[model samples]
Structures are given as structure tokens and as C-alpha cells.
Target chain A: MAQAPVTTRGRGGRAGTWYLFLVPALLLYSLFVVYPLLTGLSYSVFSWKGTVRDAFVGVDNYVGLFTNEAFRSKLLPALGHNLALFAGTMLVQNTMGLAFALAFSRARRGKRALQIIFATPYLVNPLVIGYLWTLLLSPTFGPANTLLRAIGPDELAKPWLGDPSTALPMVILITTWQWVGFPMLLFSAAIGGIPAEYAEAARVDGASSWRVFWHITLPLLRPAIGTITVLSFIGSMNTFALVYALGGSSGGPAGSTDVLGLLFYRAAFASGDINAVGTASALAVFLFTFIFGTTILLNRILRQGEEAM
Target chain B: MTPRRGAVMVPLMLWGYALVAMIPLFVMVLGSLRPTQDLFNDPIGLPNKLYLSNYTRAWTEASFSTYVLNSVVVVTGAVILGAAVSVLAAYPLGRRKFTGRGFFIGYFISGMTLPGHFGVLPLFYLLDGLNLVDSRLGLMLVYAAGSVPFNVFVLSAFFRQLPGELDEAAALDGAGPFATFRHIMLPLVRPAIATVVVFQFVPLWNDFFYPLVLLRDESKLTIPVGLTHFFGRFQNDWGTLFAGLVMTTLPLVILFGIATRQIVAGLTAGMNR
Candidate 1:
């Protein structure tokens, strides 16, 4: 029941004419993605009153992100938190995921069941994960405090999510916890893909196991390492649902967990200003530039590192 | 001694990680089954008895039934239509070498790296202009479009992997491109398409960003958005919220149980691309 816009203008009877198959998807993509992207860029330059473009404001909204007192305070922390989230993920996830992958790749028995367990948390919603952590860490009634008090001292069993000092780090840890399986899985697959002979040859040379991993296995898994790092960077930059679920839109506990995602949501929707659209669009563009720019930069460095390896 | 240490260490690390991983789920499942009063009283203990009432309360009183229906509709709509479009798009892109072929591949592949937030604000307005704001179809279109770039990238690789001789053989037998694609090609890449469908399904099902921003109607909210609303309304009742969380997550948990292989394969395949 699908039409291909028949025309008798090809060399090979049916298979010769390409781009005909591209007609529908390109049309839909252009209508949806390409168009909105351009218009959104245009919106970043214009002042908007809800839906209508009011005036061509020419980067004032962008300027406001840094100079405006109210916006600057929020934006800077949100940006810092995003970076902190990235660093935390890079350190914790890479170390844990890589360590776990190194172990799991050699694992033979009960691998499938273990795979299911590692894969389960990431399968669920990140927002739901946030809620789970919040529930588990509630100071008054959360099991974390209860268990801590049971094991250690009462003072040590302080509020996890309620205290500003611990909120962002806790959120970052919980976020990393939910996603640690993915990199673990990725690294395991990459490790498995490496031929058996490389390690055998190293061991045949009387190399230590740690040396085998450091010298032979790691260099080969460079591409996978690059992939995981980039993915983690992108994922952390778009940190919204989890943070929102944990700390609410204000990213509470004195905004310790405030992030660019929540900031954009506030600028775009929650601010209740008539001119919110313009500023929000500006934030969207800014987020895009920051995320896209860093991603490109990161790939270049990673690629260089890959080459160096 | 070294071999023994390796054996013990690997199993210990993996099994230990698994136990820690299951704690949230264990607590969630156990927490959901207990009465709210009991949960607060003994936060970490086993429930004295199975309490099915919280599930019923979340299902009916919180209107999660409607939310789940809305989520299913949006997810199914997005995945099905997106897969269809991606299959068609991947055909020419995958098989034939033509001028600007790299450009087309780069264009769609670029969408994978580019964050979705860029177009969201204007996208909302664009949908509004089409009178689709707050509509499930509107949300579905956005999601469906969002899925295309990744699916096309993945599916195209799958399509490319099939031998070219099959296409030539079909052409010589008087089969048109359409028929060859339908009968021969579509079946060969069934695993790949399955992977794409799953990769698309999880994100779309879990997404709350679009629904939160573009949809205003409570009746039409997807599960994630509905979940936030449910939590807000029942802030005091962690039992009901836990129940909601369990109900929201179970389908995905079951999906993982069934398709863990496909998910892992998809991850590796996408990385290779």
C-alpha cells in the first residue's frame, strides 16, 4: 500500500534508481527535525511572547545568561554541576565498569543471570531510579539510615538527600549506579571481542596478568573506551529526569543538585514570563552548543589518544 | 595459588556486584507489597503480609491505568512507524552506492550525536501550529522522528551486511525492487530490526521530557510524566508511590528478561558503527 512515486527514468529496471526509497523518511525528518532546528536557531535571536516572535533581539537573551544576576547564579551552578556529573561518571563508572568488565569477561558460569541483574536497573526509568534512591535514603524513615544506625553510629546515619552537602554527590553516585551496568556491558563485549591469542602470547612471555591487561588488552579496547566516555559525557550533559525526580525542578536542598536540564526547564516553561520562549530557546541553543562542542572536542582528543595508543 | 585467586576473585566481584545491584529492586518490590504504615515503621524489614491494596490504589485512584495506556499508545506508535520509515530509508542508503550517499548517511548519523534539546522549544511551537499540542499523536510524531536517525543508522548497517547477490538474483527473476525488499531483504534483517525496535522502545517508553513540556492534559500524560504527577499528589504515601514505581518499571524489567541478548548486541553493533 506504499507508493514510490513511479517514474520511468532509471537504468536498471527497479533497483537502479536510488533516493526514491529515501523519499518518505527524509520528508518526515525534514518536516520534524531539520525545520525545527533552523527555526529554533532563529528563535534564539528573536524575542518571543509565548508563541509569537515579538522582535529581533540579537543575542540579548544569550547575553542575559551570563550577565543577569538572577540567571547567572543559577546558570553557573547548573553548568558546574553538569561538569561535576561528567567527571564523577568518568571516574566512578570507568573505574568500576572497567574493573567489573575485566572480571565478567573471564566469568563463565551464571553469566546470563548475572547479565540480567546488571542490566535490570538501567532498563527502568532514570526518574524512577531517582525516586528509588530518594525513598531508600530518606533520613527519617529510609532504610539507608536505619541500616547505618544498626551497623555503626547514629551520627553517621545522617540525611542523604536532605542535606545539601551530600545531595549532588549522592545524586551523582545514584545516577552512576543506575547506569554502571551499561559501560560494564560495553567493556565486557569489547574485552570478549579481543582474540584469545593476545593474552595467551602475553602470558606465554611470562607477563603478569595486570601487565597483560595494561599492555595488550587496554590498547585494543581503545575505541570502546572512547565510545563509553563520549556516551557518558553526552548522557551527563542531558541530566534532567533523574535530577528532577530526585530534587524537583528547583533542584532543591539549597540547589545543590541544580543542573542545566532543570535550568532549561525553568527558563522554558516554569518562569511564567511572556518572554520566556526567547530566553528558553536561547538556553536550548546554548546547551546544544556546549554539549555538541564538547562532544566534538572530546572525540578529537579521544581519537588522538586512540592513535597514540 | 594464582589460578585459585583468579577464580575466586572473578566470581566474588561479579556476584557481589549482582547482589548490590538487586538491592533497589528487592527493596522496591518488598516495599511495594507492604502497607504504608508498615513501610514507615520498619523501613528495611520484610512485609508481614502481602498487601495488594497499594497496587489497586495506584492503578485506580492515581489514574495510572490511563497513563499506562497513553504510554503504550505513544511508544507503540513511535516505534512501529519509526521502524517502518527507518527500514525504507535504510534500503537505498544501505545497499547502493550513489553520489552524495555519504552525505545522507552523515546527515542521519549526525542526529545521534546532536542532543534533542536544541529543537524542543521550537518543536513545541511547530506542533502547536499544526494544532497537535497536548495530543498523543503530536508526542508520537516527535518521538517517531527522534527514533528515525538512530534506527536508520543501525538498520542501514544491518541492510548493508546482506549479500548483494540476493538483490541481483531477485532482479533477474523479474522481481521488482519493492518485492525483493519485502520478501528477501526484510526477512534477512529481522534480528537487526528487532534490535532497532527494542532500542527505540526503551527510550520512548522511559522519556518524560517531551510529554512534560508538550503535553498539558493530565489524561494524556505518559507513564514517566504521570509518575511525577502521581508522586506529587501522593507525597505522603510512599507505599502507593512505591507501588506506582513498581508498576511503571515492571514492563521494562520483563522486556530486559526477554531481550537482554538483543540489547547487548545492539549496543555492540551501534558502537562498531
Candidate 2:
């Protein structure tokens, strides 16, 4: 059979018009997003403050970032804190969110009402959530400690945020609280996508609810689970506001709660060392690359696993 | 397998979770209502009286009104301009094939993943070179530009979902491309536009990084920055700080409440697809 020629006359004109339509967004994005990124990368190679002329310095920023005792000291522990946050949210938050979503899905009345209530924390600004938690968890007059003292052992009522031992955990808990709903909603939607026939077949085979959930629902939810993991990983690693608000600019009583984001802010702005700004830029670039690489790796792994199945 | 048992378990669990979710907010309100002294003295006790003065203090002393106005202007300007430009850009990428289209699409989409902090110092220098620092317009530009990739990606998906037959019909009527887009395509994407507006608005309104880095003047502070000042001053005064937090959070809470259905629908649409 002879093939017919596709329409190409207006294609050029149409594409050109498309490019024309894109100009304003492209202009703004290039000016503000692309240019700044390239500049930051280049600036990381030079030594300069706000006013001084830039001088070429090679990989010194990256070297200093990895080697500097102060930087390493803070960076290492912050990595631990970030890891803790990741593990906590992935395990606790995701589990709880899934449970809520499953429950809400089965709920007859007030399903919309409960979903709204659950999702409220996610919509609240992180800064606002941080401050609100600061009040609720405050060591002095906060109700959390008071409630603990009133209902439980008085010795257990230590200043939640003030105690160096508890501060990072409290911050992570609050962080998880604010974000748990997001994954829940995602899971709920994904669950909705699974065919009702699958559940029907499982029940017909005498599978219990737990068995159905474990063997069927969770397996079906793999894509959502994968996505939520990557999203939460990136978000936790890049988290700035919650930690900053809870721990303040110093990042804690002893820099115990310090994360890379707060560390970058402090290094770039707090110390006035100007040299540190280059290192901070290097750190930021490292974080971005790390997240980008991790997400790519995760997608590949998930795709491969999906294909295997 | 009984639907009756399933129904009962679900609501009970939902109500339990809802109460847990609402406790912190309730604490915030109660804490804000208590006197400063009473807050320290009787942390869990009922407020001696509802002290509305804290709101006045938060508004004037913390300069929250300026923050509110600044946030309003920045968010409004960003949404209107950002959405217009993004829709325009997205239409071509989504609808038509062109030379370097892949590269152009990649360029825009990459912005979504690039961390904003990486560009902070350079942006500071860039804005300074353009003499745009410490200005609301500068903040607006940064916010709008930072948000473009996501907006473009979202709107492009939405536009792609729209059938091309409408455009064909308009063209058959002798309407030019621009008129077709203006009169036909634009109205068709109202839901997506509304989604973009809400998505961009919430983040822009609540954002702290740009205003923190670009804006130095207290008068130029947005709500997040202004709340920081209140937080600093009242580091110990839980009542006042909580009051400020409540005031700062109230608008967003009310907005979410009003648009709860839309917000959920929009998020599911954008993220799921």
C-alpha cells in the first residue's frame, strides 16, 4: 500500500508560533532560573564576596566542603538526621497514611470531610507548621509537656524542643505530621485505580483482609509507593523551613539538629566568611545532583522490577 | 466481609485520626487565647480570658499587615503573569513539533528539579546588577520564574489532554491561530488555570527563601519573614508568638477550607497524571 504524506505545511508555521508563544516564559526562566544556576556553578569555582572581583579558584570549594572540620562535623551528623527523617517518614508516615486512606475509602459518611481534615496539614505552609509546633512543643508553657506531666510520669516531661536529645526527633515528628496526608491521598487514588475484581477474586479464594492487603493491595500500590518514597526523600533532604523554625538559625542547642540546608544558609549568610558561600553553593549543587541521581536510579530500579513481574 | 462492620470501622478510625490531626491546631488557638503569664504558669489550663490584644500586637508590633500586603502583591503578580506566560509557552510544546523542541522542553522541565538555593547567591548578584534587589517586583520575578517549569509542565499536560479538533474547527471558521487560542483554547483550560493559580498561589504566598535572601528591609517582609521577626521577639512569649502564627496561618486555613474540594481535585489531577 502506498503511504500518504502527512501535513507539513502549517507544521513549520505552527511550531514557529509555538516558539513565539514560549518566548515570554523562556525569557523569564532563562533570566532567573537557568542563568542563576550556571552562574552559581561558575561562582563556586571563584573566590569572591558581594563586592570583590572574582578570582579563579579551582576545586577548592568542593575540597573544603568535604574536608573542612567544621563543615564535616556538621555535615556528617546532619546526614544522620536526614536519614532518620527519611526512615521515620517512609516507615511510620507512609504506613499511617495508607491506613488512613484505606479507612477513609471505606467510610460511608464524612469521607470528603475526613479527607479534608487529613489533608489540611499538608496545605499549611511549612513555616506556619513549624511555628505552630514550636508553640505546641515548647518546653516552658507548651501543652505537650504539660499534658505529659499531668497524665504520665513527671520525669518524662522534659522540654521537648529544648532538650538536645529530643529536638531533632521532635522536628522530624512534626515534619512527618505535616506531610503524612500527602502520601495518604496518593495511595488512596492509586488504590482506587486497582480493579475491584482483584479483591473479589482474592475473597473468593478465601483470602483474609490482611492477606488481601498484604498480597494484593500493596503490590498494586508499588508505583505510588515508589513515587512517594522518592518525593519524600527529596523533600526531607532539602527541608529547610521546619528545621530552621524549630531549631533556629543556629540549628540547635549544640548544632544537633543541623541539616545541610540550614548549614548552607548559615555558611552562606551567617558567618560572613564569603569563602563559605562558594562552599555553600557547592553543597547545594551536590544536593541537587544527589536528588536527581537518586530519583533516576529509583525510577530505573522500579521499572526493571515492574518488567520482571 | 460484612459491609456493616467495614462501615463502622472506617468512620471510627477516620474520626480518631481527625481528632489527632486537629489537636495541634486546637492547642495553637488555646495558646493564643491565654495570657502571656498564664501561658507560662498554666500551660494546659483554659484561658483566663480570650485576649484579643495579641492579635493587635501581632498585627502592628510584628508588622504583619505589611507582610500580608507584600504576600498578596507577590502572589497575585506571580500567578497572573506566570500563568499567562506558562500557558503560552506550554501550548507550543504540548501541541506542535518543532526543531529543538525536545531540547526546549527539557530546558523548561529541568527547572522543576533544580534546587532554588543553588541559584540564591548568583540570583542575588544578578538582581543587584539589574538594580532589582530589596524590591517586591524582584521577588515577584524570582517567584514567577522559579515556578514556570511546574506551571508549564502542568498546563502542557492539561493542554495536551484537550482535543485538537477544537482548534481545527476554529481554523475552518477562518479564525487565525491567535484568535483560536484566545477565544477557544483559553476558555477550555479554565480548570487547569484555576489549578495552576491555587498551586502557585499557596507556595508563593508561603515562600520564605526568596524574600529572606532578596528582601532585606523589614517593610518588604512577607508573612513568613514577618512571622520570623515575631518568633524572634517573642521567643519566650508563647501566647504572642502563637497568636502571630495563628494569624499568619488563618488565611491559608480558610482558603483551603473554602476550596477543599477544588484543592484535592486539582492536586490529584496534576500529580497523578
Candidate 3:
């Protein structure tokens, strides 16, 4: 912690230069991100239209969010839908991402080509992904139904986005398609980081590939798995575009896909009822707390594992 | 080592999933080539003959050329400004032993956990107060500000890993702090820079929330919002929508193709350390 010799102008000048370097970022961040965030927390306590001055009602928004029938019915179900989406993504996208990563690790000839192909869906805009899938699942012209009809029975080819029961699941599937590759890349890097020795040692003991993966590779890839899981959980919870595009503002077929984000958008902006903006901000606060807490817990568990190792 | 049968199955499973992943892209291209009636009628089938006019029609109808230009300007501005500020802030945080450095680092990184939309309502009013609503410059500032925390975190970590001997050697050569950073440090962190560029660029290019809230003028809308214009109340024009979707997705696909290697390398580099 000894300071280096004063080779530049002087300590004062160096400190001044440092402050100069920091100014642009600090100023912008303070003006946009930090200030707005603080103001949002303050706004959550008040009711106002764009024209009228806000009146603070201190925790009333939070109280209403919990007690009101409309909020309870709408908000609770939307939270469930968001959780379902997260669970679906964990099972399907993360699982397949891990599988692809393991395979890509061993691929020799077309590794680069295969990586590009697998990553293509992730690079597309979410709006496009939503639209493309909407087309593919359109009851009239969508190829998904056509393929289902061709391969299976006609009974299976229902209007995918139209049916209330199937609509949210369909949106989750499309989002999974677009996002699976991100976890694949993360898992590949993680699986690659596991030193070759552990796997080799397991194999030397007459263990099968599955055993090696279960006993050695899985244990070693814990950090990456934890990181991706936490990140993806937060992401799926914050997700808005796909659901908005596929299910619309109401998040319908009877509000099936009305996740927190879409609900916030509608309540705050779409309705033009500025009083509801406080409620929307309350919801945003709830989401931030939920995800942030979960991430911290996951990180702690991972750190504990690292220490135990 | 014996080539286990399970290892063979792993590749097969991966190949199968890879095929599933590519199905949408293939279908998109196919949809772009077929006429509207044909697209609906034979949604699962290949077109009888490819229609090349879909791209042209999509481009003209959606005003995608203007959207693309707007997107390019916004993304480029975000990357350049974001990277410059992040690097400058990160250098001092990484190299200097100043008091409150940890607190500052933690402060910056905390922004990453908070969703940008959490502050959207207030942000709208703030930008409005500054007369920056619907302006390209406003969007650029927002993007850069949002990206700074993560960029600084990543760059600082990369900077910390550099050998101290190199900094001392540069200092011994009469290189001032600026010169040492310019000559010695910058070259060493090329991989980190590449990672930051790709990471920031992709999200900025694909961003929808800021533009949706901030920009009301249809002429100034970015690609994602512009493409959403195809979906109206009564019905969605499926053919034109798919065509527009394909057009918007193509540049990203191409960009990913070219930078795929660097992306993988850069991402792993950050994760590994």
C-alpha cells in the first residue's frame, strides 16, 4: 500500500487528473441512473397525474398492492406466470445450453461453424423473435401447427397463441429459443475451465462418461451454473418484449401471460393514469428486491461451496 | 482414453439441439421467400418458387433503411462513449490505492442489479425536464450511462490482473501516468476492450425499452420499435411482419457470425479470471 514516487506533476495534480477522468462517467451516471432510481423510490409513495402535483401517502401503494382485490387477482397470477417462465427456462434452455456446451467442447472440425449456428437465434432482436414465432405458431398459416398435423394427430394442432392455457407456455418457449445460446456460451466456458485432470482421473478409475460428469464435472461447474441461473432468473423476471409482442398489453387470452413487467408498462404508461404510476413503481421495487435477494443468496451459496472445496 | 459410447451420444444430442435452434432461422428465410398466400397455405413446406421481392417490399414498407441508420448511429455512439468513460474510470480504480475505491467499485456495480425499467417513470420526467425527450442524443446518453457500470467492472478486473512489473518498467522509462496508460496498459487490454464493445453493442442495437418510452416520433424509432409497427389492433400482416423480422435480424446474424470467435474468447476471458 506504499505510494509510488511522484513522477507526474504532483499528488494534487494526479488526484485532479483522476477526478477529471471520473467526471464524465460520474456526471452521466448521477444524472440518469442514480438520480432517477432515487426519484423512483420517492415516487412510489405518491399519487399524481402528469399535470398535477404528487401527494405522498407513505406505504399506501405497497398496502394497496397486497390488499386490493384487482391487484391480488392480477398481480399474484402474473407473479406465478413469471415464476413458471423462469422454471421453464431453467429446465429447457439451461439444460440444452449445458448439453450444447459439453458437445461443443469436444467438437474438433466444425467447432467455429457450429458455435455460430447455435448462437444465431440469440443475436436476433427479441421483437423479431417474437414476431417470427408468432408467424410460425399462427393458427392459419403457422408451420408449427402444420408440422404437428403432419407428424402427429390433428388434435394436437390447436391455435397456439390463441388458447388461454397454451399462450404463456408458447411465449416461454419462444423466449427459450432466443436465449438458450447465452447460457450455452457461459457453460462452455465453465466446462472448459474445469481442468482436464479431474475428468481423466475419474475415467482412469473405470468410471463412465456419465459418472465423470456427475461426480467431477458437475461439481466443478457449480460457479458457472450458479451465475447463469441467477442471471437468467433475474432476466426472465424482468422480461417484457416477447410477452408484449406475443400476448399484447393485456397479456391475454384472459391475462395468462401478464407478467410483472408488462403489467407495470400498462399500469404506468399505457393507461395514462399517472396515479397508477406509484403502484407500478412499487411493483418495480418488489421485483428488484426479489431478484437482488435471490442473486445474493445464490452467490453466497457458491462462495460457501468454494470455501468448502 | 477409450472413446466411450456416452461421448458419442453427447455429440449427437448436441447436433440435434443445434438443428432445433436453427429451425427458426431456416423458417424465417423460407417465409421471406414465399408469397403471402403461399406462406400461409404451405407454412411448413418450401416455396414452389422463391420470391425475391419480399426483402425489397419489407425494406420500403417498414422504412427499415432509416431505422438501420438510426440504430447504427446510436449503437456506435454508445460503444465509443461508454468504452472511453469506462476505461478512464476503471484505470484509476484498478491501479490506484485510493481510499473509498472499494466503495466506489461497489457503488458502480450495484447499478447492474437494478433493472433500467425500474426507473423508467422518473427517467421519462427527468429527460422531459431537460428537453431531451425523443432526441437521438438523449438515447445515446442513456445507453452509455446504463452500460458504464458493467463496463467499468469488467475492465477494472482485467486491468488489475496486469503484471505490476510492466507498469514499473514503463514508469522507469519516463512514461507519465497518461503515457503509461496509453502506451503500456491500453495494448494489454485489447481483449477486454473487444469484449466490452461486443457486449455493449449487441444490447444497444437490440434495445427496445428506452426507445419505446423516450422516442415517440416514428421517424426516429430504432429497428426493434419500428418493426413492432407491423402489429396493429385488428390484425398483423404476417408476410410483411416476417419479412421485416428477417430484415432486422440479418445484420445481427452477420455481425455475430463475424465476431463469434472474438465474443466467445472475450466472454470466457472475463469469466475465467
TM-score of every model versus the real structure: 0.89, 0.89, 0.87
Candidate 2 clashes between residue pairs 3 or more apart in a chain or in different chains? none
Give the docking tier of candidate 1.
medium
Candidate 3, which CAPRI tier? acceptable
Query: Fraction of native Cα contacts kept in each candidate?
Result: 0.68, 0.75, 0.65
* Per-model RMSD to reference: 3.9, 3.6, 3.8
Cα error of candidate 2 at position A276, Å:
2.2
Please report, in order, the local distance difference test score of every candidate based on alpha carbons. 0.86, 0.80, 0.79
1 versus 2: better DockQ goes to: 2
* Ranking 1 against 3 by DockQ, winner: 1
Residue B130 in candidate 1 has what lDDT?
A: 96
Clashes by residue pair, model 1: none
lDDT of 1 at B89: 84
Pick the winner on TM-score between candidates 2 and 3.
2
TM-score attained by model 1: 0.89
Calculate model 2's interface RMSD in Å: 4.0
| Model 2 TM-score on a 0 to 1 scale | 0.89
Write down the C-alpha DockQ for each prediction: 0.50, 0.56, 0.49
